[model samples]
Target: MKIYADNAATTKMSPAAVQVMIRCMEEDYGNPSSLYTIGQKAKETLELAREDVAAVINASPREIYFTSGGSEADNQALLTAAQIGKKKGKMHIISSAFEHHAILHTLQRLEKDGFEVTLLDVHEDGLVRPEELEAAIREDTCLVTIMYANNEIGTIQPIAEIGAICRAHQVLFHTDAVQAVGHLPIDVEAENIDMLSASGHKFHGPKGAGFLYVKKGIPVTNLIEGGAQERGKRAGTENVPAIAAMTEALKEAVANLEANTKRQLEIRNRLIEGILEIPHTALNGDAVKRLPGNANFCFEGIEGESLLLLLDDKGISASSGSACTSGSLDPSHVLLAIGRVHDVAHGSLRLSMDAATTDEEVEYLIQSVKEVVEYLRGFSPIWRDLMNGKKEFIL
Candidate 1:
């Protein structure tokens, strides 16, 4: 048993990535900032890692700047882009309501500091229309930040089209691609993206490692000051070993993208189909355009946390929404943005798979979910009410 479908929260590091990290830690253990021979070796390893990460996204190595992780990368991108915008006399920025809290919270800070923010609403499919984005732009709007893929419902946005629109409007476009970067193909040039953010752990790399891709010639103020590290954009000594391992992981993910996507999609479909067979249940997000590994759904009467606890007893790992917001009892903002009412949103489950998922795991997950939902509903007063001719609590 022990099925883990919460890859969207984080993933187990690949053995190859772990070995690379260990090698770097033991053999190339030198400060990249030092001028000694060992330091030079570490520096070379760091540069090589940079090149590998850049190649995965088809970007120049100089365009990539290592960061602490996705949240830091996202914060850096938004803050710098906003500062650049302020210099050009454009204080208004645009984003969607479904963004990870990393982007949204940063924008919230900017909003209080005199930046105008417009948060667009997504359709029930959890996608923002490119036309809607175009209409949201104004003469003073300088940056448009959108995510490449939603972490909650696994809905992939129209990033290419959105990037194109931002280009036409001469606005800086940034995407929080933490969930999509290694899992999907992302050519910054082809997509017209001015800036992007990604995390290593999202793709089987070590935690606490990530990068921000800022297209060359784009004006960006340094978020971290004091050193020449990362071309003077990011400060402090680099985590050379983790960066090396992250690059290896990204390379492996990109190299196997096609095969992995197909396999994950197969399992995702099975989960979706089987889960929907449950009465008083329905799938969340777009059926066809979601991430290959994501299958989210809503039950009519049960609470998400209770169901998750029951699944855990059966050796299954899943999530109600973003792991970042797991401690909060509030319904998912993404679900609410997609028109889910409070009760329906509260009963949601997000089962995100990975390349390592198997057919047996998918089958077990479907059946375990069925048993959990039925069991929970048996004790749910809301379910009993709906069954006895009171439909008010039904989602």
Candidate 2:
């Protein structure tokens, strides 16, 4: 009866990706930086992987630069864009408030270093309007960064329209596509994206592997120091095995995108419909524009952590918010950004499915959540207060 519904946090790597990693680890362990024959072989493997990853997004192979993971890719994108902006005497940057901490925190640091930032608020649907972005841009605005899809709530942004606006303004655009890259189709050129970031582990690939897409001819400064690796943009001994396996996983994901997305959407909507049947429970994010696999909800009078613990006991894996910040006691910044009250936001739960999710598993999740919410609410003082006519204190 074990059901895993936290694919948004990370997914089990496919067998094919695993085998390729093992083969590379055992049989092809040469340094790609060397001039020898074995090194040349490793270099070829790396380039082939690069080509595969690039093709998924219709990007040129030269535009893709490998990174340790999404966070590093995000940092490189922001820092490099900031440096380029400084050179041109532009200092204002724009992003949405619901963005993952990778982009939010990076922008915060940039602000302290004297880069002014404008964080636009998202609608209750967990989406930022494209018009807001256009209005926020100024003559000195350097970069406009937004996520392709939100990690916690799964709200897909208007990246194509936003990209078009940035292009018209001659401002650099970057998107943190960690949650959307392999799960959804992306075309850097058609979208007018100047830069983008993605992580492999989000799409059933191994951890510690990712890439940043910097459109060719865009100015970018190096984040990592030393060496001429990654065309001197990212300097390190290339991780040939992980990069190869990641591309293989991306290839599999992209090839089966339509089927996989449809399957995930079915299970996600089913769970969403069943979960919202409980009184005082509300779905988070947009009902129609969310990721195919994400279904988040907030149940009044229940702490998300307590619910997660009970679900774990029932062998159902889930999350209250981003796995990165789940340890914190604060309510989700995303929920707050979308106008959720503190008490309700603290009770949010995120159940992200995958292509392999089964109907039975989803039904079990629905029943278990119903039981858990009822049980928790029975002991909640807030619920009792509301029942006893204490509405004024509920908020």
Candidate 3:
């Protein structure tokens, strides 16, 4: 049925967001940097957008710094934290092993810059223990960065608990909430978060737009030194159209988040239940402590690429761990971090739904997955022996 089940990676932009972008392109195209009337109107619109984004996270508009996307926001947050830390002789940063590449690679670069990093491990269900983070905090630890929700397995971290720990330690706390925004509730003040990152595309907003929230009074060096924009925190001309669209999308997405969450949970549960009915299958993450729309599973005796291709043939769009790491023959770091072995991790598939997903589509996906897994396993010698109840011995 041509179903698209990769909402975790990105979702189709909502019609309201597109309408706002169209209006901005057609009428509000003036440069916000200029001093003319048109520029003033554009500037006002940008400020309103900032307020909308801030309201979504319960932060002041002055704290919001728009960026190109989630990756840039993540880089800015981590780098800014490191810079602030250096001023106080605090150079150590702590993050979980299951964070997105945006955070993981940023920390890797910080390591090259001679900063110490501690990558905490996740449990088998893809959850980092709050105590582990509390234990990781130290006198020289400047920042504790954790993801609000996992991109692959759909596990939601205890962000409030972790943030409280960082607050108690008087250390800065940052969360990559790209996947969590629009799907879950977030209050920076209530969570005691010092910084947060989010992307537009993750929440049905336009791509090429995002924002980083830096709490008031946090000292951060400018990442881009150019025309004074975003209160001298971010530089370059503002993208009025995209930013406007992002604000509209965030408002709409967060307005009915509770209802959307209930619907998504229904679809995810149905999909997971159907998949578990298939023999030799296992779910990849925590059943209860996960995002509403995430349903990841692993099938024995089948390569994830083969399964994805077969599903594609059935007009069902989905994702595979191996497909995401197509060039690298390595399994997903998140899966491995959550205690999955390389072989099992290679057979994983991530099926994320959205508010637009239908029950029939979920059913179709479940049936398609069953046929594909059975077809792939049928050809395996291991399956043949197991079916025949044959004896086996291995070194």
Q: Assess each prediction's global lDDT (C-alpha) against the native.
A: 0.93, 0.93, 0.88
Off by over 4 Å in 1: 392-395
Record all residue pairs in model 1 with backbone atoms less than 3 Å apart, i.e. clashing: none
Clashing pairs in 3: none
* Model 3: worst 10 consecutive residues (lDDT sum): 386-395
Q: Which digits, one per residue and each the tens of the lDDT, describe model 2 over residues 11-76?
A: 889899999999889877899999998888899999999998988898999999999989999999
Better of 1 and 3 by TM-score: 1
TM-score of each: 0.98, 0.99, 0.96
Considering every candidate listed, which one attains the maximal lDDT?
A: 2
Candidate 1 lowest-lDDT run of ten: 386-395
What is candidate 3's local distance difference test score? 0.88
Off by over 4 Å in 2: 392-395
